[model samples]
Target chain A: MPLSKAQLLAWLGKLDAVYAAKKEYLTDLDAAIGDADHGINMNRGFGKVMEKLPPVADKDIGTILKTVGMTLMSSVGGASGPLYGTFWMKPGMLLGGKEELDAADFARFVEAGVDGILQRGRPERGDKTMYDVWAPVLEVVKARAAAGDDVAAIVDAALPVGEKALADTIPLQARKGRASYLGERSVGHQDPGATSSYYMLETLRDVLHA
Target chain B: MKKLINAVENVVKEQLEGMALAHPELTVAFEPTFIRRADAPVAGKVALISGGGSGHEPMHGGFVGKGMLDGACPGEVFTSPTPDQMYACAKAVDGGAGVLFIVKNYTGDVMNFEAAAELVAADGIKVQNILIDDDVAVKDSLYTAGRRGVGTTVLAEKIVGAAAEAGYDLDACAALCRKVNQYGRSFGVALTSCTVPAAGKPTFDLGEGEVEMGIGIHGEPGTHRMPIGPVDALTAYAAGQIIDDPAYTRTVREWDGSGWAENTLTDAPFAKGDNVIAFVNSMGGTPLSELYAVYRKLDAVCKEKGLTIVRNLIGPYITSLEMQGFSITLLKADDEILKYWDAPVKTPGLVR
Candidate 1:
């Protein structure tokens, strides 16, 4: 089955809830190497996304995603705002007026969003950023869609790839973002950004499977 | 953990409200938070807009007035303000000339301000974004976010703001801002960590006998920690770091008329006999007497290093909440910089 607009909205809702629950955990991870505000920032951004979703509920998926991006851009201060804001906004621009996304469409959406992150953050793989998760996940999604898998199966395959990527972020010294300031110290701690990115992917999977 | 506030979530809003009430000359806006001069969009002059995290009191916002920044955006405490705030602020303050964004070197500040500049440019308004990266603590651009913009930001705002007040256009304002950034260098030592209201805990823990050397303003861990010592010894260490630092080179991104362009910039090291502006700034918790003590040693250190202190600014102008520490900034000044420094200025936090 193709992923519908309602499922996308549910994914956003799940993301909001997950971030709220994991705020302290993500923040503690950041505190180990960063400024200790990732959880707070993400929670605030997604909370704002939730508030904006109701107004755009009847709109197309592209419009809904664009609204999420715009809200995050305006409300979530810091690197995540522009990085993740573009993450959604770029894909939304490509997905304009789409009511539902087939596996191929979803793959295109993820690829465009990941490309936006790369453009905005200039993060490369193993730089210990959200891109670490997105890069591998994008690869899996593209491969699965090409194999004629549905959106659900594609996301299911991408989730474990994202999970492994998130785990791999540990033991890698950060070369981007505030965590990079810690130098070698950034290595033992799991990257908060990667963790959050994994949660986002996981949320999408849950919404799609349901 | 004990901070004077109504609630953690309401901290930034409440503080902004208080500032609006206290500083009638400055206009504060909510929903998307920004503070600007009451008489903003000044007839034909360039508008200076700068912003960063909120905990740094009186910076960005406090510097908004006749001879300084035309507008300032305050993000959540210790977080960079969003692009929308900058876009709205640019719209609110862009005089006929143009708007220049004075961005700090932190990733969040740089990215958000860049986005805002693009938005402003797309609206048919002329815009430029210049970066300030003067902290000498971080040694390499190959790793980390290059050098973090520290005490020099305050100096840039004052000096470049004065030039803008004296009729420098956007390009000129941006040029002078960049020059100030290049000529200035800073080093900090933190005696303690500060508590973010929302987090309700100190960002880091520092033992009583230890101090965080080469600390940034955000309470993040410094380059290294060492045994704490007397005030004179600590002051000398901080001053020596700035004086002895080698030249720094990095590539910075600026918005041209059309798009973002990369520019390789280098900050030359301070030389003997250089005329300098010495700034001894408290990191919030440190008091005036402690700062005076630091300045006394800093003045002596510069003289010993064959540098001349032509002028000085001593206070908590740029701070990181109530963290008990201080930073030293040395600006190698030319005649033009000196003249601008001496220009008359009036704002809620500064008066001359």
Candidate 2:
């Protein structure tokens, strides 16, 4: 499955809704160890992304992502701004001039975005960070694509794993972001970063599969 | 929560706008909070930049004038600034001479600045970063983000900024900042919790009788909590950590019978005749009178130890949002560090 301009816009819209639905859960998790603004920031960031979508619907994939990146950079003032902005920008940089993304191209795009997060955030796998979920999702995506699965199947297979990974973040010790400040007290609380990562991938799945 | 602002979200941007307008000699970047010298893009001079969360006023941004930072980025309240913001500042200030990033030791600030440094390095400008971890608060014991970069950040910024203004290269300036950080140590005690505006409540709950000791400047919990006592005893306890002299505790025990380290002083970090640069800093809500009270006891301890106060910087240099507390810092300085300390500095938060 390849994502069309309309599909991408619909995906962005769906992502906004997903974040809105999960806002309280995310905010509650953040309240335990962070500034308690993860859900609010994501809702606001994706909402802005949605508003910017209609104007750039016909642009190339790279241009769309870069627009999202720059917008989030300015709109979101916290750590979420730079981390998520880097996520969208890296994919855009790799997919520049491409009209649409096939399964392999999209997997590589996600992989590149993960690499950007790792480089920018420097989070290790068990840091109880967004990397905890993203690393596994990126791996699963790469593995399925190499095994010749369709985009729909690969995304479908990855979302559950991503969700599981997010849930697993609750038991791990946090080593980055605001939660890291809590040390042992941060344990037992779900990582807000991991929750947001799940929402992002879920959006990609919806856009490509719908 | 009753802060003076147009909107909670626009606080940093509006403040930077005010800074830009108020000081015609300084330049402020609104999008990502950065303060730069008005006559920036000066060729062949190393550019110095430092930034962290926004609530610590006159900090990185305040110390951005003539003798300090060439540029300073501001993040949201208690949140670190992003990489792109730092990148923009670095690109704007990067003359042919390269740039130095003076970063605090917080994980978020360090990671974000490192990311920006990588991006700037890709553009072929040399970049170096020096992480300031000067708080002598307990480490590896957990409960907070390691040792925070506290009072020493002021000294590092002013000294390193002077070195850069004198045309020193990036590596030399970075080394100078690192040298200052290594020579300095700070410890803070909180009389009350701070109210984060967005949270609209105090960060933590402290009872009427308790005071938090060994706290980071960012409203994080401290190493210990004890009942609030008289100013003299609290000050002497705070000072003893810095002076670390057995004779000082012996003298106090002989005279006042109140010094904290009378029995354990020998095992402490400080010894006699140490040359120190002392600072009595207030958390946002603390008044100068309380700080002076702490300083008074600290001065007595110093006198007994035979330690000399080579220089003293006292004020609210680093703070949480309206937290009622004060910190004491002692920099074991040498001749070179002291000379850099006296260098001229002008910024919104610090003007000397």
| Number of the top TM-score candidate | 1
Chain B TM, cand. 1: 0.99
- Candidate 2: residue B231 Cα off by (Å): 3.2
Residue range B82-161, candidate 1, lDDT tens digits: 99999999999998899999998999998899889888999998999999999888989987779999999999999999
Question: Can you tell me which runs of candidate 2 are displaced by over 4 Å?
Answer: A20-24, A51-56, B141-145, B236-272, B302-307
Flag regions of model 1 displaced more than 4 Å: none
Worst 10 residues of 2 chain B by lDDT: B248-257
- Give chain A TM for each model in order: 0.98, 0.94
- Chain B vs. true chain B: TM-score per candidate: 0.99, 0.89
lDDT of 2 at A9: 66
* Cα displacement (Å) at residue B27, model 2: 2.7
**CA lDDT, candidate 1, residue B313:** 95
